[model samples]
Target: MPRITVAEQAGVGLDGAPRPSEDVVLVRPDAVIVLDGATSLRPELPSGGWYAHRLAGQLAEELAAHPDAALPDLLAGAIGTLAAAAGLTPGHSPSSTVALLRWTADRVDALVLGDSPVVAFGPDGPRVLADDRLAAVPRRGGGYRDRLRSGTGYGAGHLRALRAGGAAMDRLRNREGGFWIAEADPRAGHRARTARWPRSAVREVLMTTDGVSCAVDDYGIFPDWPAVLRHSVDKGLLSVLEMVRAAERTDPHGIRWPRPKPHDDQALVHVDFTEIPK
Candidate 1:
């Protein structure tokens, strides 16, 4: 089996309270599972982190029972099981992004939903697996990002704006031509983007939630994917997380990146296939 390393941290809210991270990371004998719970805008329902933890728990059980199952099929079944338990329709439930990778002696399989992503370092360098549908969805003009840009920080008015934007986004969730996430709808699992690679072609693979990936993609911490991977190998995934947090600290008011939070829950897994025994 390949050598594996995992790192995770809960994000702080705007108020700097120490809240539970909504991200989950599971390292199985043959797979890696990463889930990022959606941020909850409402006060009544269970938080997105709660749902993500539940979904990750369910997936852990299912994957252990069927190690050889198709990635999407397994996801769909687990989702259906969760939906039945909740007795809720697709849009009515809390949601999360999913990034899963399973491997055998011959090949490796991956699935991506929401913004969570995977990066594989192969002979040709780095290749990315991501779900961009959520980014493609139309968004409100004066929402969170706009508020951050205008120096509102995260306040009551910012929360209101966030909710209004979330309401608009909720309408598009799980709908045709809109983005798909792991919610009450099982079909969204089937809609996840999937990919495969020859085991021999891949040297190392990294799975990360949007919190970490946004640093590489949006924050421009590194020039490219190769640099990101190299840094992780040189220092560690925890160091990367620290670097991201440090970057956020420099711009406490969100004038630079204009994100929803100063720090997001960071979850990452690194698999070193090269470290496998001969």
Candidate 2:
């Protein structure tokens, strides 16, 4: 069997208040899952953290019951289960990004929805699997962080503006020429990006939510994904998160690295397949 390690941390809110992290990490004998809940703009509805926790639990159950099921099918089934249990309406409920890895005796499979990432380290080097369509969507008010930092009295206004912007983005989701996410719609599972590789071709694998990925994608703290993976294996995964926090501390404002929040919930899972017997 392959060896697996995971690490996670809750991030502070804009007001410097700590909240429960919305990131979820699951490691099973045959699969690994990492999920990041989309931040909620509306307080009346269930929080993204609530949704992510439920979804991850359901996915783990579904995968355990049907270990041989295809990745897409497993996701679809889990989404349906969650929607029914939560009684959420499509386009109006909380959602999350998902990254999944599953393996058999001969091959490994990967699936990604939204911005969460999965990287496979093989003889050819690192191959990153992510969905970047969210970046293409146009945001209003100079983006979420700008509005939040616009002035002292703009906090509520910023959230309201974000709610409006999110509504528009919702329309573009789960469709052609737009992005897809795991909201109330199980069909989004069909739209996820997936890849397959022979077991021999994979030496190690890494799965992370955008929180941890921001270190590479947003801050440029590490030169490349390979460096991030090596660091995680050499040190602890939490050390990578500490590095991100150190960078954030240096740039307290959005001037250096523009983002909605200073800190984000982080979750990561590392798997070493090289030691598994063939």
* Among all candidates shown, the one with the greatest lDDT: 1
Clashing pairs in 2: none
lDDT of 2 by residue, 1-278 (tens): 79888889898664557998988887778898899988887678888888988998999999999988888899999998899988988888999999999998899999999899999999999989988888776666665656545542325655566667777887887777888899889998888889999999999998988878988888899989999998998898999989998998886655566665668889888899977646
Model 2 earns a TM-score of 0.92
lDDT of each: 0.87, 0.84
TM-score of each candidate?
0.96, 0.92
After superposition, which runs of candidate 1 have C-alpha atoms over 4 Å from their true positions? none
In angstroms, how far off is 125's CA in candidate 1? 1.8
